[model samples]
Target: MNITVFCSAYSLDDRYSAPAAEFARLLGTGGHTLVWGGSNAGLMGLLADQVKAAGGKLVGIQVELLKHKTYPGADELVLTRDLAERKAQLLARADAIVVLVGGLGTLDEITEVLELKKHGLHDKPVVLLDTEGFYTGMRVQLERMDAEGFLPRPLDQLIAFAETPAEVFTHLTTA
Candidate 1:
């Protein structure tokens, strides 16, 4: 399967990178493909390296403005006209989506994907890797949304949550 991973573009803590590396290793060895942002920094770079080390395919979607940050070893690099185009490609190509700890951009990706799924635009499984309880606040907010009747369907139908790599992969395979 082609798993699109949305993770931190920049991170100073090894807490996040360690699991990301392990997840990548499992992804590669398990015969899954990885699609991500094209950057050699933070969790993105760490995960990409592990995937290559394990001999898995890596597809990078990069925007023209961020060309300077592109990672060199991706199996294939796709250049996009802008961020919107890059995001479109990422969503269009993935069989499932895994979100790791990240900042604002990651949140944007998650919300957009969830919105897409909520609207029945896609049935792809979306899992959030709640590494270190990073998504605690967001989870609470989602629950609130559901309770308030703001969602068209149950939150569980729109997204899945995994606290470990094992759970993430399991959800992907069974999704």
Candidate 2:
């Protein structure tokens, strides 16, 4: 499987980094390719390193503005004109999507993907690794949307949440 992961490009504490690392190792050992932002910074860098170390392939979708931060070890790299193009490429290359702890950029990526899924643009499974309740607020908000009939489809059908690295795969395999 080609798994697209949206995550922080900034360094994070152990609480966040540890889970991301575990997930990366799992992705690698499972023989899945990682499709992600091409940054060689922070959590993104760590993920690529661990995945490569565990024998997984890396495919980076990078924007020209951040070209200097591109991961040198990626097995394949594609440059995009902008963030929008990068996001489109990320989704285009993935069989499934996993989100790790991140900031605004990560949030933007996942939301765009979800919005597309909501419109039935794609049927790929989207799972959020809700590490340390990082996504509790987002979950509550989405649930409210579902409960209030603001969503056209059930929230659960749009995305799934996993508490552990292994659980993420379980959702993927069963998706």
Candidate 3:
């Protein structure tokens, strides 16, 4: 599987890092390639390191502006002219999408992906690893949207929330 992961480009506490590492390990050992932002910073860097150490392939879709932060060890790297193009390439290459703890940028990536999915632009499975209930608020808001008919499809069909790294894969495999 070509698993595209959207995550923070800033360092985070162990509470967040640990689960992300575990997820990367699993993705690597399962013989999947990681398709992500090509940054060698913070959580994104850590994910690439763990995945590579576990024998996974890395394909980075990087924006030209952040080229300075590009991962040095990626097996393949693609440079895009802008963020919008980067996001499009990421989705185009992914068999599934996994979102981990992130900041506004990460949120933006997931939101756009969901919006595209809702419009039937893609059917790739999207999973959020809700570490430490990090996504509780977002999940609640999405549930409300589902309840209010704000979404065109059922919430479950659009996204799956997992509490652990293992659960993330379970959702993907069963999706």
lDDT of each: 0.90, 0.97, 0.98
Q: Best-fitting candidate, measured by lDDT?
A: 3
> Which has the better TM-score: candidate 1, or candidate 2?
2
TM per prediction: 0.97, 0.99, 0.99
The CA root-mean-square deviation of candidate 3, after full C-alpha superposition on the true structure, stands at: 0.4
Kindly provide the TM-score of model 3 when superposed on the true structure, using C-alpha atoms: 0.99
lDDT of 1 by residue, 100-122 (tens): 99999888988998998899999
Model 3 ranges with Cα > 4 A deviation:
none
How much is 63 displaced in model 2, in angstroms?
0.4
What digit string (tens of lDDT, one per residue) describes model 3 on residues 136-168? 999999999999999999999999999999999
What residue pairs are clashing in model 2? none
From the highest lDDT down, the ranking of the candidates is 3, 2, 1
RMSD values for the candidates in order, in angstroms, are 0.9, 0.4, 0.4
Superposed by TM-score, candidate 3 places the C-alpha of residue 83 at a distance from the truth, in angstroms, of 0.1
